[model samples]
Target: MPGFLSLRTKTTSIVALMVAVTMACGGVMIWNTYRVDRLIEGMVSDSVAAYQAAEALETALVNQKGFMSYYVMDRNPEWLQRLGEYRQLFRMRLERAQGFAGTAEERDTLASIGDAYDLYVAAKDKALGLYINGDEIAGGEAHAGVRDQFFKILDHCEAYKKAHEEELFAARQAVHARAEQLRWVTVAALVFVTGLGGVLTLMLGRQVLAPLRRLAREEAGELALMEPNEVKAVTHRIENLIRSAGEAHTELARSRENLLMAEKMVLVGKLAAGMAHSIRNPMTSVKMRLFSLNRSLPLTREQEEDFQVITREIGQVDTIVQNFLEFSRPPRLAMQLESPSTVVDRVLQLLSHRLRSYEVTVEVKREKPLPNVTCDPEQLKEAFVNFMENACKAMGGGGRIVITERVVSETDGAGLAEISFADTGCGIPEEELEQVFQPFFTTREDGTGLGLPISQRIIENHGGWIDVDSVQGKGTTFVVYLPMDSEEKK
Candidate 1:
């Protein structure tokens, strides 16, 4: 009940039912016709057999009369034999008529004819014997008796034929009646099926087709009024709006974080600048005084060792101050059209000694005819160096670094040249992946954590982006997508 059929299926089923009804009607008509035909055939056959039997009896009787006259006149033995043969033929015809009888009345009439025929045969035989024995008077009396019996037998044969004819007529009437009944029934069935089919068709048209046509008309009108180019333009604008909104949301969040980080960097830069200025003046005076003291008086071994340690400590502080200042305020980029592969090759060459010392294998993969990207070669090389050094540090014992370059097309119809740095080293955790680009966020004790932030800034300034994917136990991959076309350059 829940999965009831649609109007179309119901209509089709109704039509099929009508067709089946028509076929059933046709079958009934055929069966009735066959029954009637069989009845008529049996009646006709019986009638023909009865008629033939009557005709044979009449012919035999005529032959017997001719033979009796010949035998009575000639009184010859051959004439008596011919008379006997005709008598036998008459008896055979009566027997055949009895066999052809269909009804009980007809059989009774044939039986009576058989009894009369037997008496006639016996009298004729006696008459034939008397004629042969030279008693013509008694033989004539015997022949007279045979004629009376023949008339009675003839009457019975006529009755049998009449009965068959009556039966034939009755059978014809019954066939006509059955045929008439079949005709009326077939007509009624056809009318009923046709009427039902018509009603179903009308209902289907009203319920199913009418609504479909209305919907089609409405859709056609809408389509006719709309221009293809206008529709496409609207769709394109909507898609652009959606993409812009998403990008703006992501950029806003990133901007908030970057703003906080920039403020902190600015404050650190100011503090480092002040500290360096203050510390360098005092340290320069201390170095000058030491040089003057060493030149004025001779120094012992323990005293010289103490002087060397102080100098080394002062140098380490200066190095720390310089690193902080550089991290706070990076240098300006000198942008140019440079091959990414060339920058990568230069970095690998510069780090060759360090990489070999750590037993790290470096591999660069690039297809033929690599595209040049608009970027600062020095900045890009420095970024690559920082990535490679981090990879090498992660694999303290030994590991492999693979760099692959290729051209990729963005969904916005912009072409970008992508470089991927994949290292088989300990990877960052999933939780820390998001904060990897934040300044001063590092797992390493000696790491400044400003390397990735600086690298991300450099890539963004060149109208590009950086992405990372890593599994903690497996390895890490860093992908840089830079715009290849000049229009992308700022």
Candidate 2:
């Protein structure tokens, strides 16, 4: 007993170890599954409920506006009653939204919305009272205040809902990434365990058999010393091991579903890159042919116009292919420390002719003594040009474009060089704002839709980010934040 572990004792110990490991693994899997499920459920519930509440509030406000308009125009008591109903609904929705606030910022926004709504309601009521009592002039003046309050409420709601939606989207992306990592870990665990089990089985078999073979060769003495209790203990351990293995196998099977999702993503990226490369040569040849034909053609006005249209279409296709190639095979950045204001001024100078043609006014405001940013000057200028051109196109006729630059601290407290392009042009719609950064998404008929995406890529390559804020029918602003140091290079 002091010098040796018997074959029966060794087998029993190994079996118990396997059982304990399997049970511990199963417990961890269960706990992790539960935690992920609970988090996903909470995010979905809170996001859905918050959005619904905001939508309900907006709908109630719209209804109130319609009913108020009807009452003002026709002096209808029924319309007033409907207005009151909508007013109550609005208050209820506001309270529900307040309850659903997911963050302190959201709570503050909701409070501001509630205050604005209350003021609007008060102004509306006073206007209605005056109008009913035959003071149209006073009622009109009071109603103007209601409009201002209403706009403020809308602004607050929009900001609150937009922030929450972004947060929810980020949370969902994180959950997906975590789930993907867990899947890979589980697959790796299974493979490791299978290999380990096979090795252990072979080593244990040799160890147990070698002892038995030596005992058999030696004499009947060792065989006679083997106890019935030891055999029984070994048998019990084998039974437990069999049961644990069966349970572990079942749990692993359940966890192994959809193992190819990450593989599919990798395959898709390679496929896209291949497809883009394949299309580029053909597209360039077609464009060259079209240009050659356009120059060589001698035709009537109608024929020339038709040829020009075809040539333009071919050019557009080439541009799209070029964009695809650019995206799939990005050029290496030539980084250098340069003044952001200088880049902005150069881009503005290059676009001056186009801006003049479009009747768009350009203004540059630089916070003096701003630190130089590390970036590819040419690429940064390209990004600035894209933004300026986008602003001009958005305006259509004429507008003011303001380029502001300053050194600022990023969200992570890192020093950043900030440049903003604010334009008095038609703003992006709320629903479409987030999608603007996505490749091949555009609102314009003639747009290739890769400008913003390419600009975003360039900025991100330089270790920066772009932030956009827009209000429909008012204007749009794009802020680019680049690191002051070449940390990305390091």
Candidate 3:
């Protein structure tokens, strides 16, 4: 189906074309009227010319009368000569009037008028001849007849002139009225066409173009909305990426723990080797003393003193072996509710020798009513020992170590207990800080690099997490977060 404006335009064009054709025909009618009016003008002009010519003829006839009177009354032959000129003038005018007669009827009427004029001329000529022959009564009677006929011809000429002029005027008025009517019709049609065209233009714009434009605008708005939605989709994808990053971080942490366990085993093997090297001389002396004692010789005081030295060396070797075993294979937990402060205090006791040797100052701040945490006693002890030793090592010669324990309320559905170990030592470098908990990645050559990694594992296994804060050349802090006994629900 066609649109509203298209239909309207079709209707309007048809009407306009029809009106234009009709106006054109009206113009043709005006032309025809003009031609008819011209014909009437020609007829009117001929009639007026004929009437003037007839008047000239009448004046010539009067002059001939005067000439005849002079010929008859004074016997002047000159008058007769002049009479011929006057008669010739009157005949020429009569012939010219006859030439103007148009149609046969008009020509017959003009011929009748001409005949009357000829009769007047003939009578005048007769009168002049008679008067010349001295027949006065006959001459006067002929003159009177000629004058009557002359007046009758003149009256006929005037009547035709008046009739033709009236016809011309009536024709001109008819043509003018027709023309005015045509002009008014044409003007009305043009005005109608202009008004229709304007209406159609406005309707077309509103009904067709405007709607298309509105549709375009709506499409643009939809496109604009689509763009933002696409951006939102991109934003959602980005959020998914961030969540993936968090999961990846957790997996990476577990991988690091496994690596740390491997590295710890390697370090243990090396430590065992070093311990063997360190005890070799002690063992040799102990062996030599034992061998000598077995030779069945009497024991001397110096020899016995040597035996005691051997036994003491053996005891030192045993102690070193115990320490190595402890650090090498820390036991898995049989998790239970325990105080974090108690675990930290045990680690401090275990590292007391080195802590004293380095002149390290230590501070312990614990919540008076700290929440109970669930973890293995020995495993937690091992994790704390690693943290304490690292703190002491960072201090180098000496620095303050602050150990704090606090009960944290669940704010975001997580843990409720925290233990913090802070040391005033040269902090780890910013770039290296993230890698500190990675197994086998350490700044110090002597570092096994398993301490932080292992500690992180133990804490995570106990439903906890570890965080580190450090500034190069300043200090380092390690915080262990553990859920309370009641918070194990998490």
Index of the highest-TM-score prediction? 1
Give the alpha carbon lDDT tens digit for every residue of 429-450 in model 1.
9999999998778999767677
Ranking by TM-score: 1, 2, 3
Per-residue lDDT of 457 in model 3: 73
Compared with the true structure, model 3 gives a TM-score of 0.40
* Whole-model lDDT per candidate: 0.80, 0.78, 0.73
Q: How do all the candidates rank in terms of lDDT, highest first?
A: 1, 2, 3
* Steric clash count of candidate 1: 0
- Residue 279's C-alpha lDDT in candidate 1? 80
Query: How do the predictions measure up, each by TM-score?
Result: 0.45, 0.42, 0.40
lDDT of 3: 0.73
**Off by more than 4 A, model 3:** 1-330, 413-415, 487-490
Clashing pairs in 2: none
Give candidate 2's TM-score: 0.42
lDDT of 2 by residue, 333-431 (tens): 998878888888789789889999999998888657356777799999989998999999999999999988877775676788889999999999999
lDDT of 2: 0.78
